[model samples]
Target: MLINLSKLLSGDQETITEQVTLEMEAFVSSIGTFPVVEKRSFPLKVSKIGADKFLIEGETAVTLDIPCDRCLTPVKVEIPLNISREYDKNTVEEEAEDENLIVGYNLDAEQLIYCEILVNWPMKTLCTEACKGICKKCGANLNHSSCTCDTVELDPRMAKIRDIFNNAK
Candidate 1:
């Protein structure tokens, strides 16, 4: 959704509130793509702070299906986003921040939301804290069922003694 900032920038309106619907089904980034399960229509406030400067603000929550780090199970993770950013029209292209969010004189609502989601993305996602994860040997889901892999730990210092006993046997 693109919002025209002409009125706000033209001094006709000092501030304006525009409601934009988030129409993204998935978020594609450099890391990977995550499916967006839920989002809501929200209003964004655009204010002309000074000459050629504008401030945009809003709040919303987005839920996404992110795979767990340990078990790789898809988990619905809700990420809350607070959008508050200022744009300067006279900024240089190389130095400008969020330059892609501005298309001509219109503000890109979807792009703004994307930036927010990207910044607030969790470093690690888990289905549960006690998730047993997958088996290292047979690649079985430990949380669902146990495997018949080795279940013993021997101290390295006693390895020689244990090996001697094994040869005697």
Candidate 2:
């Protein structure tokens, strides 16, 4: 969804509010792609703040299927988007950030929402706080069952001593 800002830039209109529909089925980035399972339409507002400057604001929510960091299990993560950005024609500060939501006099609503979601993505996701994670040695989910792999962890400083004992066999 693209919103024309020519009227607002010309000062013929002080503000423009439109109910924009999100047309993204998934969010793609360098990390990975997450499916957008749900979304809702919301009103986006663009208002003139200064000469050749404007403010874009909107609120919407979307649910994504993000995997758990420790267990690799898919979890439903609802990301609430309270999008706000400043469009400037004088400097390239936004371009440096790769915001690229605004090009010339057109605002990319989909890109704006995508950027907001990327900024607010969770750093860590877990199925539960007490999740036991997976058995690294056997590749089994510890939360569901136990594994027979050695649980002892030896310090690196004692590796040479353990190697000497093994040579005796």
TM-score of each: 0.83, 0.84
User: What lDDT does candidate 1 reach at residue 166?
Assistant: 93
Candidate lDDT (C-alpha), each: 0.86, 0.85
- lDDT at 86 for candidate 1? 82
Candidate 1: tens digits of C-alpha lDDT, residues 1-169: 9999888767899998998899899988877889999999889999999897888899999999998889889999999988888877667376333677776779888888988898899988999999988888899888999987767566776888999999999
Q: Write the per-residue lDDT of candidate 2 for residues 1-169, one digit (tens) a residue.
A: 9999899878799999989999999999889999899899999999999886778888989989998889888888999988787867576464454357678788888888888898899888898988888988889998899887766667776987899899988
Tally clashes: model 1.
Answer: 0
Candidate 1 stretches greater than 4 Å from native: 92-97, 152-169
| Residue 8 Cα positional deviation in candidate 1, in Å, after optimal superposition | 1.3
Reference-based lDDT, residue 66, model 2 = 90
